[model samples]
Target: MFPRTLLLLLSLILFKTTHAQLHLDYYRNSCPDVESIVRSAVQEKFQQTFVTAPATLRLFFHDCLVRGCDASVLLASRNNRAEKDNPENLSLAGDGFDTVIKAKAAVDNVQECRNKVSCADILVMATRDVIALTGGPSYAVELGRLDGRVSTKASVRHQIPHPDFKLEKLEAMFATHGLTLVDLIALSGAHTIGFSHCSRFSKRLYNFKSKTRIDPTLNPAYARELRGMCPEEVDSRIAISMDQTTPQTFDNVYYKNLERGRGLFTSDQTLFTHKRSRDIVRLFAFNSTAFEIAFVDAITKLGRIGVKTGNQGEIRGDCTIVN
Candidate 1:
């Protein structure tokens, strides 16, 4: 058996090897204009609709949460059972996929960048643009991730946090990704700009359990409004903004809403009800700058989770297919 000191050195060497290939300037020589090319393409899609911004942002988070930020969510398996096909991801908007496809096409059009840039990197860039264009901080995203080759539907099962998850469950889920309670609260703020299908949150408005009663934790007036929008046993396809106030903007209003019992998801409201996380929620509710800074830091760390670097994965020529 190897000595303890030798084992420690070996572990460090392995970690370094896995992460060594990912650098901010990985494309400096091969695709000098990759960012500009992707940005322009995503902007064109942004002009098409308001949904694109949140959709793209959700795509990035889902991509990272399930199988790391390797663009596996974009894959189209021949079996029609890729990660995106899972029921949990069915709510993910198509506009997000369109934005990334357009951006990848733009990259391919560039002379030196054709088939050189990874879809994973394009995803990171588009996510950054989504946040910036939505009036959030425009922080730098580190690049050089490789496209994942596997995207099984089974892989997506239980990977993302459910809307009904409680505070403890949410904390445990984020902890799996090396995220903290603060990260969970800050990242949940992404709900500020997105829409959710009635089916996703109807339980809180209708009979939460076997009893015919609305969730008491939810604001009664808001529950009535949601009930109108999503009548019991009606069309589940009806949608509602996760944040009713300034739904299109990306800000601390989500935290403020949580304080008012207007949080759309059970997991969201639990942050305020749970003693451990309530103080942090109050802090962000009153301080947009603090929320912004924490969000930027958390998302940056999230983007790095389980990232594939070096020869572990390939730079796929197409975002939808392994190559």
Candidate 2:
């Protein structure tokens, strides 16, 4: 039972964002092919750590947005050579300080590799990392991506899919990229780690029974872990996304949640209820290795979507600043 006082806090967060200082741009220029190979090597070395694609993506985007992806973020704020090469942003947001600076660092890494690789891969991967770092599924996507010369904040708002979407809406979005419903479900496997704002799932927490909020059907032990992270009455505004149960690592917990009827979002839980979606959910739950591989495949598939095959695009000499 929530005290009700907490529910009142919801009203405070309803104001629209004043507009973020950050926005993404797209380009048509292709980075030299070497960028893919080099970035992949960098990603592979850090695979075991909690960072990797997401962190690198962050560095890629931030750098491009600031100084054309020259790896400038790697440089130290104090202007020291030793600090410039620092890779700690992977572990710490903004190196555990200011995350915006880390966003800049992400841009830096991407630019440094931009001359060698495509910005598209860098941007797609960056979104994946944001999903991963927040505790969603981390799939392996393909590299050798090209750069975009004209990305913008408005594009992201219009282009990126939102949590509020229903099945028909999602299917259409994926279909735009030649994705199927199953792929949508599988792609959603990223929900394993990333979380949402309290507003995103407030209906589940406040409207549903507390027991429902703490579904007894879930992994009893894992449920405890969840409860600790999400107290019944705490700020639903900052509620962690369903993927947080084990955000650092990739695994079958997401599917398992489906089996237990604990899928956090309406979109997530829907997979288990529909006859068509159930099998994929079950398959994912029972096989961790298969899930990881499939997840990667799905991500790779998503990477190729919505691009101009012939001349729909143009490459910018710079990823962040543009020409």
Candidate 3:
């Protein structure tokens, strides 16, 4: 018998899985090699550049956060503004967009699967590949998501949380998408493999608030190191690893850094200070497997947010524009 709380959590996940049209073998008959095809495409790009894995992973998070995992983030609007044009999303690496486009083309080349698979599904698989390739736990990605037809600049600004969000605001944002406090902490572990522009977190390095010149929670030495790398508004565009320990790997060291006031973003550091989420942050810092398990669970749930299904969206021949 399960504990009452455990049973309730299981029920919620079961309910979400059923309604989201998520399943393992959704493309078994239609496109049996879909996952492999995407894996190859992502791998090819990754070999050429180290950024591919992080870029692809970030693309998935941005896509899911704004409009579910519908690949709307890949849309290219002819007009002046679109989701990709939003200042929040403007930093999305072009290599990530190119990787998805290349993967979609690979899928289309298969005679049995030509124009049959959704770009949304390909993005999910590519994200899984990114995790697997970067020494992280691999999990089966659910399929059957339809391609969303809509993408707008307004949604990106309204939906995505910035790096500076406080714990309470972060919690509310995640809650709106059916995620919990634990999920927020786990998903943040994705930072282990990515880089952030100094502009995103420079306030913590200098002039944080009236209380202190810099964020008091940040380690003084570490803040000095970041200052040398970023140097005020002059070099704000320079990128720095989120995980100073192992920049290329996806691991729990990000949480460990938070324990020592080395978290790069205000949002990252607050997980350690806020009473409600502090314990959760410590748990992941001490146990890598626990963090990986929670992350897989959180990402699985995240992929289902606001998904388009049934006859709601189309499978575009080219992922950049809706058919």
Q: Give the candidate number with the greatest lDDT.
A: 3
Q: Judged by TM-score relative to the true structure, which candidate is superior, 2 or 3?
A: 3
lDDT of 3 by residue, 1-323 (tens): 22443453455456545444778888999999999999999999999988998898999999999988899999988894778888988889988998899999999999999988999999989899989999999998888889999999888876887888999999999999999888899999999999999889988877678565788989988988988898886767788999999999989999999999999998999999898777778878877877887788899889888778878898989999988
Q: Which whole-number lDDT from 0 to 100 does residue 86 have in model 2?
A: 35
For each candidate, what TM-score against the reference? 0.92, 0.56, 0.94
- Cα shift from native, residue 56, model 2 (Å): 6.5
Model 1 lDDT, residue 104, Cα: 94
Worst 10 residues of 3 by lDDT: 1-10
> What is the RMSD, in Å, between candidate 1 and the native fold over all Cα?
7.1
Task: List the candidate 2 regions with Cα displacement exceeding 4 Å.
Answer: 1-114, 123-145, 152-159, 164-166, 208-241, 308-318
* lDDT digits (tens) for residues 1-323 of candidate 2: 22232232233234312212111222224334333443344444345444443344444434433323333333333333222233322222332122223332444466544444334444454555555544445644444333434333222333345544556676776676555665677777766644455555545444546755643334456555555666667865554647555654546788888787767666777677767667767777876655555565555555454433234433334433333
**Best-fitting candidate, scored by TM-score:** 3
* lDDT of all predictions: 0.86, 0.48, 0.87
Which pairs in model 3 have colliding backbones? Answer: none
Count backbone clashes in candidate 3: 0
The clash count of every prediction, one per candidate, is 0, 58, 0
